[model samples]
Target: MDILADIATTVLSQLQKPTLAFLLGGMMLAALGSKLEVPTPVYKFVVLLLLLKVGLGAGISIREADLVSLAVPAAAAALTGIAIVLLGSRSLARLRGVSPMDGMATVGLFGAVSASTLAAAMAMLDADGIAYEGFIGALYPFMDIAALVTAILMAKMAQARSRNVIPQNGAATMALGGTGSADNDGPSENRTLVRGILTDTLQSGAISALLLGIAIGVLGRPEAVYASFYEPLFRGLLSILMLVMGMEAWSRLSELRKVAHAYVLYGLSAPLVHGAIGFGLGMIAHQLTGFSAGGIVLLAVMAASSSDISGPPTMRGALPEANPSAYVGASTGLGTPVAILSIPLWIWLADLFIGL
Candidate 1:
């Protein structure tokens, strides 16, 4: 009873926040076709600021954190993320009759983490006075990299398997050197592609901000760092960025109709499924690691959210056969809205799991 009441209050409090108000306002303006816009560079800067702030806060908290205890949850989060990617992609392909490449693309986008959703989760936690460990921010990269690799690999393997290699000449056939090495070569090229994709993901603005923030936070004293600009301006900047994100997400919603209903349904249901899995894993992790309920909640939300920022371009580059409209549309369109709306549900699930 208390849990439900607390969640109700928390939901109401979150709805009343200026940040969410800004988000809704941005969506409304976009809907009305208002010319107001945040410049591209400015928007990127805001995202960087929010990511770095979160990372730095996490780093400072790690000072007193137990490495072993943290490892348990981190490991669970990583495994759960990988499971989400594989299972989600396979299910989309099997259930939707989507081409293998397109399904992988969708999975890659949804399987990864969303920085905007992470910011929203942080905002929710603060509003609710939830206590979470600092190292939770570090889990984002692990999931991001894992999902990217899995998507690329799935695409490459499917492409290789689908090809019907035929020799046009006798000498050319002899040079073919059997299916073993040729098959080996495909996987090898995929590995190289995966490596390149990983490099790009790590070097992206979001990941870079997180890495830089962690470095600064780990080196400086927590009190001094929090008193500095990083702590003070984090939430306001996050809200503004989310407002822009909401506008961007709304713009993409029309693209949903460009694809099949299966993609749409998958996009809509992804957060709920992934969040439940994450929440379950987090509950098990709590028993093993004794991590805070807040960290568990963050982990669950992080797992639930899809990557709208880094996922599309990378997947398109790696899986050119896939329809860009389908992956990008489903992800930013149905998926983003579903993910944002699902934040409260994830928190409520966290409360149920953690007894908070």
Candidate 2:
């Protein structure tokens, strides 16, 4: 009963926060047929700023962090990403009316990190006075890259198997070019595919911005500028981003109607399940590294989030045969809103169970 009360209280409190309020407001505006829109350039700029702030803070924290303490949580994050993709592939991907490639693409998006959701989680933690590691943001790439790579690789393997040209082990052989027919170009093709995915992921705007900021923060002393500029603008920028996302999420809802009911179910439920998996793994990491409750909650948030910015373009390039309506519709329409709203639940659970 007390836990239930606490959850209700947490949710109510979070709804009042500017980050969430703006999100809800945006959604309401869109629902009411308001034509209000944040320009594309403006939204993109806001995202870059938010990512830079996160990366800068993380880089500064990492500079002073104990590397050994960071390793366990990082590994946990990577494992969580891989696990979510595999879990979805087995379940959601196999659902009636869902194509395997489209399902993998959808799960891949969910597996990847959301910069906006991560920012919101950070904002919520700060508002609640929850302390977390500075380097926590640094774990983004580890999970994002791992999930995407694993998803694409799994899809390719499935495709190869379907074609009967490559066995399960043959995928590796194709990449490594061992003992296969010399005339077979499978090895070159596989290597190129893997290389292309990695290159595209790294070059994506979101990842590139975060990574650049981290590099700058680590190598150069940006504390004065970071404090003066990025710090002050963080929340305000995030609010705008949230508003944009909320409106965008509303618009995407129509796309969901074209997909299966299973997608709707997966979109609604996956966030909670994936988040729980992250929270559990984070607890294990906490036992090993004493990861903070705030960090655990953030880890859960990362797991819950879908990649609105990076995953789509990468998936389009990699899995062109996959139906965009199914993956994109499910993610932007249902998954993201659910993930954002669930932030408070995760935070409350962390505080109640894991404490500060």
Candidate 3:
């Protein structure tokens, strides 16, 4: 009963946050048919700023962090990303109306990190006066890349097996769909596929901005500018981002309905389950490295969030045959909202177990 009461209180507190309030308000406006929208260019620009802010902060923190402290958590994050996709391939992909490739793509998005969501979690923790490792943000790319590579590889292997492509000279030369190369044998084909996925992920707009910011923060002294510009504007810009996301979530609902009921269920539940898995691994990392409760919460947030920006384009290019409505709809329409809302739950759990 005490635990239940704590959860209730945490949720109530979460609902009152301006960040979430803006999100809910946007959803309300969308539901009322207000036809309001943040312009696409503005949204993209806002995302860039947010990513830069997060990356800078993380890079600064990473500069002072001990390599040993970072190792355990980073490894855990990468493992979590791989595990989420593999688990989904077995369970969610096998459900009625969900093809294996489509299922892998959907889970890939879920497994990848959401920059906006990470920013929100950081904001929320700051508001609550929780102290987390600043370097926690550095874990983003590890998890993001791992999930994407694993998903695409698994999806392609499944595709190959399903088609029963015969091996020639002990190696199937059939190129995986998006590689733009057909001359490679089975092993070489896989190497090419992985190399392409890594290149695409690294070169992606979101990741690129983040990596640039991190490099700037690490290699230069931008603390003055960071403190003067990015820090002051973070919350206000985030509110706007949340508002845009809420409206976008509503617009995607119709697309969600076009997919199987299984997708809807997966979207709604995957965040919690995935988050718990992250939280559990975080616990182990905490014990091993004295990782803060707040860092644990952020790690869980990364696991909970579905990729809104990078994962979709990557999936579209890599798994072109997969239906967009299934992966995109399930993620944007349902998974994102649930993940956002689950922040408070994770925070409460982290504090309860680890003493924030």
Root-mean-square deviation of each candidate, in angstroms?
A: 4.2, 2.5, 1.9
Off by over 4 Å in 2: 167-191
Candidate 3 lDDT trough over 10 residues, lowest sum: 166-175
Residue-wise C-alpha lDDT for candidate 1, range 1-356, written one tens digit per residue: 98778778766766677666677777888899988889998988888777877788777776767788767887877777788878976699666557777888888888788888887888878877888777888778888888778777766656655564322221111112244433344434545666778888787767788877877777876567566787788888877887887788778878867777888788888888888788888888888878778877887787788887777767776677789888888888767767776777767776666666
lDDT-better candidate, 1 vs 2: 2
List where candidate 1 sits over 4 angstroms from the true fold.
Answer: 1-10, 165-190, 219-226
Q: Which candidate is the best by lDDT?
A: 3
> What is the lDDT for 90 in model 3?
86
| Tens digits of per-residue lDDT for model 3, 291-330 | 9999999999999999999899999989998999999999
Q: Against the correct fold, how does model 1 do in TM-score? A: 0.88
- Residue clash pairs of candidate 2: none
Model 2, 1-356: lDDT tens digits are 98789899989989999989998999999999999988999999999899999999988888898978889889999999999999999999999999889999999999999989999999988987899988988999989999999899888767766756575434334333345564546666677678978999999999999999888888889999999999999999999999999999899988888888999999999999999999999999888889989999999999999999988999998888899889898888889999999999898888788776
Q: Clash number for every model?
A: 0, 0, 0
Candidate 2 structure, TM-score to reference: 0.95
